[model samples]
Target chain A: MIIKRTKSHIAEIFCNVLCVFVITVVSVNAQKLNDDFFSPKSRLSFGNYLFLEKDYLRASNEYKEFLKTDNNDTVRFKLSESFLRIGRYEEAANNFKSLFFSTSLTDEARLGLFKSLFFEKNFVRFRQYRLEENYTTEKFSHDIDRLNYISYFFDSEPLPDSSRLFSAFADLNRADIKKFYYMKKNPDTKNPVTAALLSAAIPGLGKIYTGEIGDGITSLITTGLLVFLSANNFRHDHNFRGWLFAGFAALAYGGNIYGSAASAQIYNAGVKFNFDNEVKLFFEKHNYFLPEFDFVNR
Target chain B: MKKLFYKYFLLIEIFVVSSLFPQDRLSIQFDYANKLFQTSQYFDAITEYKRLLFFDEAKKYSYKAYFQIGKCYKAGAKFDEAIKYFSTASINAANENEKLSVYFEIVRTNISRRTTSRALQILDEIEKENTNTFIRDSINYWRGWTYIFADDWKNAADAFSKIKSDHELKKLCEQVEKEKVSVTFTKAISYFLPGAGEVYSGNILSGSITFGWNLLFGYLTINSFAEERIFDGMVIGSLGWLRFYRGNIQSAEESAKQKNIAIANKILKYLQYEYKGAKP
Candidate 1:
């Protein structure tokens, strides 16, 4: 069938042929592009994607891969942040330290380094690092000072004056800081020696002073019963039973003194642990006073 | 005519390339997102899927991205966010089949979250909408799983039984039910006999101790009373015998609960790692 083809039909045929050719070319180019989707440049965005997803381990890995080709400050900061997020504090501290120069990220990195050390629960080491000017970006020194004051509460170091210790914190946090400071300086800690003496003089008074009311009452009742049993057996002329009861009474009295001293130490340890936990939780909830990432603005 | 043809052809080619280029890029992005999900990088997978949703101009794979994001959230144990994305997926689904798949995913997420009622409601909705036997059986299967997660073995068995007479899950549910000791029965036995509940709950050592304490103290109290030692009798009876007797009953109840928990956990562990069938 020889069909009559108009000029418009000829134009349409060329349009269809051109579309097919263009689609083929574009698809081939696209396939090539897709094959390199995991290249280093792509890995940077992929790492950021993982970071935002809170996939810290994989995000860090991606960032590390990207770092082999690119020494970007933002990526370095994110890599450190990823390590910090996953609780690899030592690695995080080292990563953050690499950014501790006169760059735009210096103060943040210094702050991040302190935070990393703080999370490691090595307050002593943190304090030592804080004192070194090499690690100190002076702009964030006040932040470090706050962390240092927080460190005193965590350790057995003698606390600085309340005014000096709380100088770094804003007024909003000063009250809580002061509470922790006073708790350290004049800790509601029982004196072990005094506790032992008190328990020796009165069977369970030491436990009561150590804030263990239930234990104090139990100790008193047990000791009183043993002593009474010994006296009763003696009055009744049962010498063997009386001796046995007296022996028990003596052991109970000695144990009460030792236990009271131990109780005082446990009380002090609990106070320290609770305070440290509160401080850590507070800082974590507030994101350590760091600047928010302005990804949208960028 | 040839010049005009070439101009029109050039215009069409540019349009075609521009249109097809972004689609290819988006498809690659989807593949990368799915790779993340496959590698168990769920949190990152969700982010990638959201990126696809952001640039999906024609909404070609928007619902698919939403469904995948829901799955990623569910894998991360973020049930609330999982449900949120799944709801969005169902809303954006292009057809009945896609919506149906999303609905099943929502049911599975609810079971994981132990939101049994919501899962049941969805299953009922599916049941009313379609009469396909396969769909009905699938709903019943998930219902059984929900009951299992809720620790209601009898209900689980009942749900499974509705699937088929000799189904493997039905058998498992029945076996779990048979092996479980009734907590109420143990508590009642302990109330009547001080250490009997502990022995019933398979705690021989504690049962012996509890019994021995009650016996020795009981004997001491009676002997003290017979010897006219009223104060000693009262103390021994009240503090020693009564305390141990009460403790025995309480411990018996606790042991029963622990036993039930252990049984449920054993089955749950098996299901998680070794069971060869559909799972929530």
Candidate 2:
């Protein structure tokens, strides 16, 4: 009977332990759920989730809400990133500027600011800001220099020599840069007056000079044939026919002269169009030579 | 003491089991997913809904989760993914009502993908199943939208005609059809008589200029040949007369196509922005 009573006593101890265990486990889970749902950092946590999903607008709002009570570098970087994703480069630049001083995120924010400026396509300001005394990250100077050089291609800045270009850029893209440089320096410009004079002196010669071989051949053959016909008609006593052929020949000659000048203008336009396309494609494919930042990474 | 201890342990076990069992654990996740969806985070919403389905032990929200995922994909313009998830929902549907909703979503996604035939086939399936008048009308509405997206205004009109005799879209389609010029006719006319096609298509200045040049060059070539000027005849006939004639015909064909595009664009733009109807 005593042993039975002892067993009962131990069972009571076990039951109380089990009861406490259940209550504590349930309360802990409940508390965690409540905290996750209604805590101060819930919006921040949700914002990070949204950022990972790349929902910039909503994520930015959440970050802004969290920033009302806190001032942290990571959230600031993300807020700027959210602006950058939606093409609000001015806001992105302004936001990025906040994290650009003496923080672990200084390099990232500096890069972000420059990227915003680059994408804003305001080349003048981008160049000017990069030269600003404290606005650059030392580690990313080469990247900034490459972007600065690329900007000159689209703007009025005369391209610098190959020696002055970034060494990293030289290894991969020096040839293209030099080609663009030469095109800028010694453009294949055709003078309209010279082309017209060439066509007048020798029928269709100006079209050949402008690289329109087929048109030049056709014009030369037609003008030559018409002139020959006019001369032959006059020799055969068909005077009226001879005068009409002469008039037609003169018209053809004048039209060819005008067409030659137009062709040169078109050739120059083609040159400009091709150059513009090449520059745009190169910069776009290279992402303006900026480093890929994993800001949205979880 | 043993009896009380046993009673207390039994109560604790019952309390833990009953409370946790009645928690409706997936409800919180469902609400969160819905919140994500409402905020326009479509891609994120898809993940949340998918996660809800993954964690839902009882499969209570499986159908709803899959359907919401499909809706999210459709919003993001990911039509193929949308259709896949919608099909999964249809397969897992507990009743005909669930299946009908899934089918409707499938048709909508197919229309946005510009797959008119696939959308029509689903509509046919819905018809064969003999749904209610409301569903039938909805099918016709989306089918009409599918036709419009496919650029087949005549068929779009025909589709909308099933809903009512004088449906708004049908009337618009009729107007566009009447106003649009026939591209084949323009091409054939230009082949027979250069510049006539352009004139018919309302390009008076271009047609006049084309005809004038053709006439002038034709006269020159014929007169040269009659005067036994073979070289001049050959050069002007091949270079001046043939080039202008071919160019006129080509330009006439192009103008007809352009006019057709312009007429279609007028309707498309209205459908895109101004029309207050259901759109894809």
Candidate 3:
């Protein structure tokens, strides 16, 4: 009877020990699991996965969280790159600028900052930043120079000396770059005032000169028809009809002259548009002459 | 005896702890992302969901994560992105029910985007595969909604009637059909009599002016011809009478189309803003 009582006492102690073990293990494991899920290393792992997937927005979020605890230069560069990829140029520039003085990524970051400024279309600021001796990088100076030369194509600024501009690009790209340079310098554009004078001399001549052959023919036929109708009405002694037709003919003549001038302006705009597209296509094909980053590709 | 007791105690402790906690890292992550979604922080929610996906190496939460991401895009009115993610979710669906749910989401998105033919095609495909009455009914219901979004009230009414003889949506569709002007009738009436189509389309003032001008031109053309002034008759007939005649038909067709658009827009606005039912 005493032995049975001892066994019962042991059973009670065992159950109590199991209960305490379960409570302590569960609480500790839960807390550790939660912490580990969002720990710095875990965030870096997830951020790298997202970055490789090209999901930059989420990757940037993860990288930002990771940066709060770790000061890794590659992570900072990638964070800036993520911003650049997503078109947040201001944020990207700021992030890249933060890596300027004390990181192995100084040159790449400077180039990234220049790229951000260029993409923002802040040409003046981009040029000013490029000219800053302290901000310039020997490693990517040629790349920055190529980007600076490319910027001139986007605006109405006069093209730089052809030799200097061509020298910034590789020999393979020089022909296309030279073509863009010449197109920018001397765009084959018609003068609106000249077009107006031509149309005033002979109806629709200016429209023909502006590459609107169909519109020129229609204009000529319409004005000629109205003038013929006026002369015909006057010959038939219908004075009121003749005067009405003459009024219409005069309006058509003035409208044709105005339309010719507008057509010439449109033609010039088209020429500029085509030139811009070609230049853009060339730069895009060459990746704006920017050096490829092996780390990013990997 | 002590070693066996310790082993049993450890097993009991493990079972109790696992059952009590239930949630692992992935599940906790899912909850965190869901909380972001519940708060209507869609963009952030998408990022969190993506984070879950990136770390969910077992792919246990892939279907839910993708489906939720699709929902986030839909809420943002990014329909193309929504469709793309929904397609991914459908590909990852583990069960027939999950597949059906993703299909419905895709159909609903297509309807919202006004891709009516694609929505109807998906509904048709669902109908062909499933013989279950409840699933068939759901297919018909979505088919009806697709027609309504396409502005084809007649087909909408037909589809809803297949679900129930006296369905409320069927009745609404019928009412919309009644309210809309018939473009064909408007064009036909204008062919018979100039400007009569516009009168039928409820533009009484414009119709009256059109009729008066056409009659005046007709009279002038006939009078000039009767007076043997052929040139005058030709000029007036070609430029005045013919121009007005063609214009009257075109204007009538345009008025009818405009009236139908306004009717459809009114009902659609009600459905969008006031109607308290599940919608595509």
Candidate 4:
């Protein structure tokens, strides 16, 4: 009977020890979760640090953790924004989609989604979303029209001439005219291989088509001079020198032909690139002339 | 016993969650790599970055590593290698900006190597693949430099003018175009006037050498004939005086050629090492 009583006493001691361990563990975890969610100022500070450092992925994660606890729409919006900053467009779109259903951030969410889709070049979905979502009315109507105009760049149809379709763009007062023309005309440039072949057939022709008249002329003249020199040297009975000059002439002639055509192709590609960037920037600045999601707590 | 179970579970949960959360290891590595890059220890920094890629937590750093490697090669003037690495980086980069940066490096490196045609080719590729206005403008600005290096001053001027801004590059290209002398014209001028090109090239010493030789030979030929020793005069005048006169003409031509080469080299050297402007 005395041994049984001693065993029971030891069991009680063990239970108490176990209880303390559990409580300590629980408190520590609870503290961490609480710290992650409840401390807005700290979380914001950390998020900002990551953002400034361009650690967008990490910033998004931190903001996500903050949002889990805080559940503040502003914080959620910012978390999605971090994803956008990192070019995690799909994730950003999904996050924005979540906010779209219920929150004062619905308009901002829709706009952010549109931007992400537009950047991802998902025209079909972007168009669908544009038609469905209601953008808040504001005084920057001209800016909105510009954004709408640039968005059409991602559309499937050919762009109309700025002089005809976008004469109004002239009055819009943006320094992106070159950018627009570059985008509009880029797709129409002849094929690179074909241009290269054309140039190969006749020096500088490719460059001329690409609007590099000076380069074309120089290439033709240089190649022609080399050819003349080589032929003259051969006629003078300097066979060794003639052959050497001929070889050099041939190389230069061939290379220039190749280069000219290649240049034309490159010029077109550059135009296309500039167009996209200009359009994206227009949207990034919210058309620069348009009002963005500037809801004053209405 | 139940309380003990809950407590242990909580501790385990906390430990598990903490472990699940990604840490600053990637960040720390990027910071170190950036620091190494800034210090110009590019090769060693590259190794550190490749280690990060091995971990492969995020594929983004891999692109950064490749881009830096290209840059390191470019810095060392190994442009062919740099272009290869840049192409590799562009192929694998996660985003448009990263890819564009890689393409930019390819153009820049090629231009630095005096492979203007290749740089222009890559620039076209960039233009086709990219859709950013700022990037396009920046690329065009560099394209102007490519034309300049290829000795197509007029095209360079046109490219810069098309930028439609107070872009310093446009003004610089215009300056280059205006200041440029036609190579053929310069060569022909030297052929016409023995020392004119030397004068144009600001080589008084060479000009004087040419002038002195021509004058001395002229006097020698004239005086030798006046002496009335027909055979002696013919031989001396034709072989000695005439030869020296011809040699002076050749020397003048040579000096002008050298001067032209020097000018071209000066422009190339500035572009290669000193000009604080877009290159490719």
Candidate 5:
């Protein structure tokens, strides 16, 4: 009878222990579910959604959260891509560089790094990094080469020989590229010194050369009228009036010379602006000849 | 033995059921996001709301999440983003009242953005769609607010008068209209008599100075011609008399405009800081 009581007591104890165990396990699981709102998995999914929506700032925040407890190549790449889209070049370059040594995305990462440098206008560093074959990939070498050539046009750097530069682009784009190259080499820009010299020889002539015909004519008329007034006053023995008119003439003539030089500078700036716009449009149409990442669609 | 078996089964069943009901989990997330919003952590709240939207597969929180997102953006003064999300919320609204609420939110956002024309257009559309007296009155109220934002005090008064003859906003608008100077009248008066507009706009000192200059230049020009100094007369008339005369008219118009702007700004400041009313 005592042994039977002992078995029953043990059974009761077992039930109580099992009840506590079940409650504890369920409570822990419920707590986890509550915290799942900001879990890494949730962050990654939200980050991907934001990235697809082109909300790069928020996407980068989410990706940063996800990366805290996990290591993911695609997520890292996407994080870097987000920085690039938002014009955060330094962060993007650093993130892309982290994947340079070993990964399925090594080439893509290298390319992304180069793009970050290029967009930041860090052309010198971009060229320096491009020379390291370990940092570049055979698959995208031609793309990097094209970017390098494009960088030359953006700055005062001398272009490579025509044969070397043209070979980097496709046959269809070569003609336009060659045109831009020549335009860069010998830009149709007016010389400011020459413009000043022209204005000195004939009042407002420099302005006319720099494409301000109305202003040039106005300047010429004002200076000529002031000089004529000065000469006529002097002829009439009105010495004070003559000196006043002569002083005004000298001021007008000096101002025209200065204005002509400034006009020439403005004209050169406009030519450069147009040329840069054309080059930018041409490359934008070509997508900068960069390879598309299929993963972005997924 | 059967009783013990039943107890274990119950424990396992509880676990399974708790895991299966993700709605409870979603409710917790919504509360978490709401807590963040209440604390004014708007940027973080937006991310949490977006997460809720992304995970809400049954779309049960679609309207609420989108509406909250709109509110968050509106709080940040991001009117364009607020309007975009409010539009999305309107699409997801489950009932007529819900849809109307979202539409009103968009109109309010547009009002705050100073897109008064669009706000008025939306209010017109809402009035046409709803014939209920309360809704119509609400539309007129918003229309009044829209006109107020546009600095059209007369139209604002007219809109508020539609709601009630003795509406507070209507009285305020009428008072503002009375206090405001007419730019066109000021310019016209200045054309006939130099600096009259500036005086009318309450710049007595500046108006007197401008008038004095005009009188002096006019006298010099006439005296030059009288003295048979044709060159002096021509120069004084073209450069001195004409310049001051034209300047007095411009200054008068500018003074009227500036006085009206000051009047509008006072009312706007009152509404923003002192007046106790529902604001956009």
Candidate 6:
């Protein structure tokens, strides 16, 4: 009777211990659930939190952090959108490109990507992408055309139908096409070898072609003065000084030719860039001057 | 009871450890920064000091560190950066003299670097505020040097004369007074000889160029004369040779006067301000 009584007491103690263990485990699991729900695992959740809170800087930071942690194209596309919302098109374009290949958001990303590039003034890349078969962004068609015209500024390579684009853009912008045609006709001004040869024939002819009359006059006068000094030195039998002045005059002459050619090229580039910017500003302000069609059949 | 006590102890221990680790790391950073400062690696030292200023917990030695940074920048001839740190040191200065000295140094550096206008403004303010006579005198002396640097010889002389019997400075003033030349003289000299005045002022290259051109024209004139080309000789000779000859003599006298004045002014600057010995 005593042995049976002891065994029942021990069994009762074991049951109580089991009950306490189960309670502790249940509480721990509940706490873990609360923590997991509060702390998001994916970047999209964090990005939304930042976007909704109107914390653009923090949103940008979170997006960057997300890129580090996960290479999710969807998240990257959203991140590009976030950059666009903040008016950071340069950063947005880079992030959009990060999602360009094999992402479900490729078409949407490409459209955003072109718009971003357009906004960043990267007309050359935008136009190049426009020519690609896979890169169709119907929404930004007018933008693509405008960028194609603007690409003349950024491209160092010779354009195929620059005159046509220049004329088209000039009509749109009310710019003087005569001046553009004048620059196109004068290839000698752009050629350093031709400018140098021309300058050697006459003191300031290269500078005149480069449209730097004041600098041309100054260069001519400076070189002339040095040559005169060299002649005077030779007359005085100062061979060393004569040679030195002659050398200086030669160098100055050469420098003027090279500088004129470079200046001409720089000026031409500037003209194109200015015209491009005018067109870009006009289009951007007028919603790329294209008809907005929101609904798509697909 | 024992398990509960042990659990609370463990919690306290973890909190303590977490707190201590960060503090210890911060102190180590501070020590490292201080070490960099002591080693004459001032550029790196500045970076370390900046980090400590941002992160240090106790915030002790900040003024000392800033003062050291200023000194280092001063040593490196980065006067603008030195001035910045010195101003920071002055703002946090515990000692009045230290603040005054920093202010003085800032003014001195500006004066040395030929920023006379700004230095003069600061000097005026310091003179008004500083009741200390020694500082006041030092400020006045430096003001005199500042005037000298700006080539304001008359004002420099007057400033130096205000100091109680600096014989050497007085002598410099006398020299400037004696050697002063008319502005028209310099113009006249250049007008007469293309570069003769510059030569008189120790510009050998300019003098030689002028002399060479004149000599060439002289030869041309003589050669033309020998060949019975009278018009050519007269034209070249009159147009070039005569002009350069008269120019050379006028430039020589004008430049000599200017050089004497410059020398006198420089002497005054050095004696009154730079020389730390007896005044005379």
Off by over 4 Å in 6: A1-209, A212-298, B1-35, B56-63, B90-98, B144-164, B167-234, B242-280
Span of ten consecutive residues with least summed lDDT in model 3 chain A: A289-298
Writing each residue's lDDT as its tens digit, candidate 2 over A155-213 gives 76777765776354856777877777778667787888888999999998999999989
Comparison by lDDT, 3 against 5, better one: 5
Candidate with maximal lDDT: 5
Between prediction 2 and prediction 3, which has the larger lDDT?
Answer: 3
CAPRI quality band, candidate 1 = acceptable
Ranking by TM-score: 5, 3, 1, 2, 6, 4
Model 1 regions more than 4 Å off: A1-28, A35-68, A100-151, A161-179, A239-252, A281-297, B1-23, B28-59, B69-100, B106-137, B163-168, B187-275
Candidate 1 clash pair list = none
Arranged by DockQ with the best first, the candidates are 5, 3, 1, 2, 6, 4
Candidate 3 docking band: acceptable
Q: What does candidate 1 score in Cα RMSD to the true structure? A: 6.9
**Candidate 2 residue-wise lDDT, B1-280, digit = tens:** 7578779878877877765665545677687889999999887677667556655668889899999999998999989989988998988899988999899889888888989899989988898887688878888888888887777889889988999989999999888888888878987888788788899888989988998999999999999999998978998999899999999889998898888889989999998899998777
Q: Return the lDDT, model 4, position B242.
A: 72
Backbone N/Cα/C clashes per model: 0, 0, 0, 12, 0, 2
Candidate 3 lDDT over A1-298, as tens digits, reads 9997798779878777777777778777778877776899989888888888888988898899999999998999999999999999999999999999978999999999999999888999999988889779999998898899899999977878888888887798788778778878878999999999999998999999999999988999999999999999999999888999899999999999999999999999899899888878877887887887887645
Q: Report per-candidate DockQ.
A: 0.25, 0.17, 0.31, 0.02, 0.41, 0.04
Best candidate according to DockQ: 5
Clashing residue pairs for model 5 = none
Which candidate has the highest TM-score of all? Answer: 5
Give the alpha carbon lDDT tens digit for every residue of B1-280 in model 3. 5665776777776776674567788898899999999999999899889878878889999999999999999989999999999999999999999999999999999999999899999998998999999998899899999999898999999999988999988998999999888999999998888888899988888888889889999999999999999989999999999999999999999999988988888888988998887798
Tens digits of per-residue lDDT, candidate 6, A110-206, equal: 7777778766767767777888866766645555565565445444546546556665453655354344434443432255566666677777777
Better of 4 and 6 by DockQ: 6
TM-score of each: 0.72, 0.58, 0.90, 0.42, 0.91, 0.43
How well does candidate 1 score on lDDT at residue A224? 98
Docking class of 2: incorrect
lDDT per residue (tens digit) for residues A1-298 in model 1: 2343576677778777877787777677666666455578777776777677677787788889899988888888889988988999999999999998756788888888988998787887888888888888777787777777666666677877777877777889788778767766776667888888999999899999999989998999999999999999999998887998899999999999999999999998887788678867876786665546574113
Pairs of colliding residues, candidate 2: none
DockQ of 1: 0.25
lDDT of 6 at A36: 36
